[model samples]
Target chain A: MPRTNRQWSLARTPRGRLTTDDLALVESPIPQIGPNEILVRNTWLSIDPSIRIRLSSTTPLGYLPPIRPGEPLVGLALGTVIDTRNPDFAVGDLVSHIFGFRDYAVIGTRADTIGGYGLPTRIDTRGMPPQWYLGPLGSSGLTAYAALTEVLQLRQEDTVWVSAAAGGVGAIAAQIAKLRGATVLGSAGRADKVEFLRQELGIAAFDYHDPTLHESLAELAPDGIDAYFDNVGGDHLAAAMDNLRPRGRIAVCGAVSGYDGAPHSGNPDLFQIVSKELRIQGFRAGSYNHLEGSMRQEVGGYLTAGDMVYHETIFDDLTQAPTALLAMLAGKTIGKTLCRLTSE
Target chain B: MPRTNRQWSLARTPRGRLTTDDLALVESPIPQIGPNEILVRNTWLSIDPSIRIRLSSTTPLGYLPPIRPGEPLVGLALGTVIDTRNPDFAVGDLVSHIFGFRDYAVIGTRADTIGGYGLPTRIDTRGMPPQWYLGPLGSSGLTAYAALTEVLQLRQEDTVWVSAAAGGVGAIAAQIAKLRGATVLGSAGRADKVEFLRQELGIAAFDYHDPTLHESLAELAPDGIDAYFDNVGGDHLAAAMDNLRPRGRIAVCGAVSGYDGAPHSGNPDLFQIVSKELRIQGFRAGSYNHLEGSMRQEVGGYLTAGDMVYHETIFDDLTQAPTALLAMLAGKTIGKTLCRLTSE
Candidate 1:
């Protein structure tokens, strides 16, 4: 092991747009672990736009702890156990934890060293890409899965629409709703993303830039949607509200459109809420933390059966995480953005 | 019984504000009843903001059939059965039904005379003011009761806020939430209305015109609220979203703010719907139609026990329905607005 661990610490809390200057890469003495400890060497780190909510001084509501300044940022990452003093963990065991954003981390007894989300869990690659553990079998995928079953309570007859359809959580949400025997519709920003949604995911997908989303949605689902899984907020949400049928359900799992500290735009036609008897609610991935085991198993089964697919855009090293996150916040990334610490 | 039935029919759907000119007072010979029929002489008629939705040519999205031009405008009213051939009804039985805005209605065989909701059920006044049935035990009361118990799911420790707290549904909603052991707060438009909310309803109340609702909400519920029952949907809704805690619930029963047919103004602060993990869903009183019996029983129990109270603003005679409805929608009336057709 090297004498130092390289990590990105919050240089200054961001204002408006997130820039690379918001984070500072620094060298620190390798953390020393106590009894019942394991050391991890991170291989891949996930960069999600939700991380921006934490970078703000006023923590976004819900249950997640705020990201503090002058501290290493926390995120999901797949890693290898390099050393262990704990009987529960063995050297060379593949694992995943919120101990990412650093090349190496000490796992126990030091308050800042270990992951807040319990112990690092062993990862089963299932002969698929290991990075899938950070996606389809991880927090983002669990979010889509739990939201469909618990929040939306999607039925086989439901006609569902997914906004931000090509994004990580939206991709899984669109696919899962389809697998549940729903008639699915999806909206993506770019033509290629719309193509990916239609060709790969096999859903009727449209680009949001073409005219108004409300008109396209009316043409696509003439009867109206039974449910909506919203990843992008604003006008896409407003359009869905306008078209949602009576007793419709919405699982607002993400609001990537408002992550830039901008006030939420688009005055939604809310009168339809009463007139249509619609139910719109917001939920966080962490709320489904207990169902992760079942979510992972179910989502993993579909991935192996070829009924599901996912995409990843990789940053070569941890140093590029800030840049990757910025690209995602700017709506440039089509799918999951990952920081690859080491090559396969 | 009178030889002629006088009713208020729609003249032309008003484009903006509803005026008496939009309604035509006409007389038709009372129709003869069929084998299974009843004739009702209306004594009271309800004037609700929701009535405006029906008068529009473009039907509001829910299941309620739109009011046709040149047809008697439909509403809820208390009446006495003047004649009956059906075993289900008896002559002179006090009843309530959605067969109002008229005097002398031939209620069987003809589709237009009978209430679209259902047959007139005999009113069980429970010894309180008989008119309390329309305010606290009728649809307005049902709206508040079901919204608190089923929609908001009020817990013992919850802090609740009721918008339009002096209005029909809002008045009952404020009382019911308080009975459920939740600390209650309300917002009304006028000083007198605010005083009514505080003294008569016995809840912490504020005037909406007081500089900013958001600041007042923060001051009222410093820790944040667990539930909100909204009758007004503009800035009041925006303020509620700003103050609700995580896992908060909202039951959007009415949007009186948009009753004027004006474009919905004041863009609501909706990002909090995501940040707060809020569940904001819209519902109608009729959606809880089946639960009316239980709601009546529960609400009646409170009224009899003096644990709950209600108010009514009466407009005498059917001719004043248009005037009454216009007044209620204009925010002039507090509590239930009823047009009295006859003395008990």
Candidate 2:
């Protein structure tokens, strides 16, 4: 006899507003493992705004495939393996996989099994909580790492400005730039988040909703900024353009500010790019899957040495997953938002 | 005894239209040559749009001191050496120097001459007209070369888009990209200029005042543009962004479209830069002073071999210099707008 499993499936396509009815809790029979497959009991599920694009029928960028109706909402998640047929992965070993929004999943053992970097599996969450793997030391941390190191090639003497500084990716990117001896400045929506960046992360400076954002930045960085890690677009980018030094680099990691609206309107004045010689680049974390080994080793060392810190907004049940995602979309959550499945 | 010489001095600042009264023709004694200096009779004076910046009290970006009222307006000009005290330069030799708008000039003989790029005192106008040195094989050609070769890193298989296609820099840059094996496309304001680009340069495609500029470009380059040499900014940049491939490179050479207007209103939408991962870089031809020797050899050889061609809208007398500049500012000139001091 096999065990039963519960998974969240996309019930319908979202038109305007997403409702709980868009997702349905369904029962599924436990899948049998193949010779190279492993059975994982997922403990945590990550909810990200990028999932909204996957839910749409068509996207302008055309990066990822659209999710089908009645199919599991697939994304990145943290899980622990209970059974494995592959010789490399032993039973009881904790792992992270690109599995679905399901409690238990039977995934084929491939080179991408460990950190998705084709590296050997060596996951040891010693004193820190396992959930940190999905937030800072995981996909979000890698995004910040690749955007700063590979894309922007940030220098030690450079000044870095990060938008959406309280979010999962921005928070880690600011800290990483700080760790590399850069003067770090950040922007957040609320006063508390601004205070959090200064008081908690020891960020050099932070601001919230200043109407003269460009002038404020010019005052802060009299010499001008060397690089910008943009998570929130729109006015933040416009302000950044005014403050960027000649030959400055901008890493376009996300545009959460105008994700729901048309991208044409509310764009920044780009004529300065000609006079200033600015470089704006967009990057997805998956494109850097090859660097996951060294990235994990470096970020994991930072975690163990108490050099990096991360926060998670946790939801208790799977049914609350929709609400958690909505909160993130509405900018109501402070950090990485995840749902903990109790029935696993 | 040396003859008395006349020079054009900046008399007053212009709010809109510039008049001959704005410049005063004053007579002064011809200058005496120093140990490292040479005396030359000015033969041809070059008039460019960049001179407008010198007339303003505030200097433009990447430029030196503004032209003070009551001082002579200065720029690059070709002349015949009448006397020389330096061993490197000889009498009766034709030379180019950054002399004031005067009939005779005394310039110091440094390794690099009066031209900002410190070019050597060698002459190589074999078979081609000497005036061609003032346009294509001079600063204009060097600007196009540096922006395309260094900044954009123009690749052979790329699709290149050049704005202001009939202007001095744009016309040459389009040819250079085409020579590098790129599929070249361009935009000109007038139908005649558009036909000139199509018939004369053999560009892949062209457009003129089309409201559907973005759609037209998308249709022309279905695979997306790989590089953009921007001479005109504003809506052209926005259209380029719409058609740029992921990781496309842009050389921001000039913003002639919005140079006369305020910054924000005439600027293009820059938010697409994030999605496209565009590298928009500004370059001053003066920055690549070291490459002048090799660039002159290369571009000069192309001109001599009949592999390259250029057109100039020549004004007959020194008095017409101001009108010629005004015509260039109004986008009325087809090719390089130059003032021929006297008939050859």
Candidate 3:
């Protein structure tokens, strides 16, 4: 058992692009578990793009507040309960919580669940891989499910476009949309990712960097798409608006194009929204935690039936978590970006 | 009556700012009504902002096609039937149709209703001012009513903000929203229009030019607004997004800011939409023609009970239709902009 805990903390608010020097991995004495508190040895951390928003000097309105310098970064992680004063949780139980980017976390029963990274919950992996909970059977899966079902109300006959279709939530969205029989067109920044979406995911895909985004989208969906699953904003969102059919629906899950110190491309011809009577809705995963059980059931079934393709770009240990995030944001990672803290 | 019919035609596709030189009123012989056709001597013409979009070389997708040079312009008009070859219509009957910017119209049975401008329908004015059919009781009224009821689903607890609040649709939307028991705030560009909204319309109003739009909106609605009725897009839309509370709703009726030659102001922090979980729906009055009866019942009741304030900026004679459009687009008009062609 480790006697000390090492956690990643923000050394400064990043100005443009983030760097390793901006993050500090500091070792400290393991925290003591108080009454009703649980000590968790975090084994896996989920590296997501939304955290980049919090690293700025001020986060967007209604979002989680910015993480100040020297504050440990918070994220979703899977851990084993090493010690527990809480009656409900037992030692050796694998749990999921929002105290990640660290080797150990001290959790309380009454921890805040504002972003739906709720209190630690025990996972019943059901003989499946435990890391799957951090990917398709967890927040990523729920985001895709809620967006397609609740927001988009995707119909089988509809043709839908998914931007950044090689990313975590988007990949799941593309597959689930196809499983429900919608014609899916996926777009990615890189040629390799576009190939993956075409050959591996079996979805009509395009490289957004080729020619013009409008022309690329036009080629894939000559009749215009019925719905759009937006993971990249800026030019991608503008293209979707231009190519969407009348009365089209758009589900905005993320706007990663502007997350890495780049200004969001504006002038999206908002008149398109009025002219086409388009409906745009922006959502986050925390709001859809209610659908987690059903997501796990359906997605887990897909995994068991070999009908789903789950991919991961995982770093070896906690020290590489920052590298994993930079790689993912740079569009180098293939699928869900994860940091494996232990070989357990 | 008159043997010659004076009709407004597009002289050229507008380059930037629309000028009187862009429009030419040409006199032509009145056409005879054919079988299943009715001849209407237009009495009042509604000069709306949407016409500016048609004057451009190309319109937004799903919108009415652009009117080319030498083509007569079209709009909503109130007229009296002078001759009828159809059994359903009788001479001297009052009618409303989409054949404005002209002194006379020959309406056929199969006229397209793509934008919900159906074939000519006789309007029973019920002793109300017949011109009211073009203002509070017509397309403008229906637009406000549908936005509040259908898209916003306005609640009594909602604090709603209406942009371009002194314009035809915005004024109606602001009043209707207030009548539905919601706290309403209005914004206009000019001081007099702001005064009209505040003192005459009895709503909390602000001048968008005073201070920054965000500061002005924040001064009016400090906590946050629950709903936004957007008529002028660009900065107003961005401000609303910035000031909307979580789960806020925005009903986009028009984007007049972009309809003119000026480019739409962009870089609205779209992340705010996701953080606040905002739902934005763009709609047109044509889509909500079904609610006309209910709108007439409610708004007509308000006007009859002396609880509604209806104002008009009238341009005399058919020649002033171009001036009326320019004034309306430049925010020089208060309430509905109209061209009164006849004394009757």
Best-matching candidate per DockQ: 3
Tens-place lDDT per residue, model 1, A201-317, is 999998888977987888899999999998888887888888888899988877777777776667788878888889998887767777888987788888888889788888888
In candidate 1, which residue pairs clash? Answer: none
How does residue B264 of candidate 3 score in lDDT?
80
Off by over 4 Å in 1: A11-17, A34-38, A56-59, A63-71, A84-88, A107-119, A124-129, A261-265, A330-332, B63-69, B85-87, B109-116, B124-129, B261-265
Each candidate structure's TM-score, on Cα atoms with residue i matched to residue i, is 0.92, 0.84, 0.96
Superposed model 3: Cα runs more than 4 Å off: none
**lDDT digits (tens) for residues B246-341 of candidate 3:** 999999888898887988884467777788889989999888888999999999999999888999999999989999999999999999999999
The CA-based lDDT of model 2 is what? 0.74
- Chain A structural similarity (TM-score) per candidate? 0.93, 0.88, 0.98
Task: For candidate 2, list the clashing residue pairs, or say none.
Answer: A277-B282
DockQ of each: 0.61, 0.39, 0.76
Which TM-score values does chain B get in all models? 0.94, 0.89, 0.98
lDDT tens digits, residues A134-250, model 2?
A: 777778888989998998899999998988888888888888899889999888877777877888788855564664567668777888899999887777787787778876888
Clashing pairs in 3: none
iRMS of each prediction in angstroms? 1.8, 2.9, 1.1
Model 2 stretches with alpha carbons more than 4 Å out: A1-40, A52-58, A65-72, A81-95, A99-130, A261-267, B1-41, B44-74, B80-128, B261-271
Candidate 1, residues B23-108, lDDT tens digits: the string is: 99999998888898888988888888887888888766764677888988878878888889888889978888777888977666
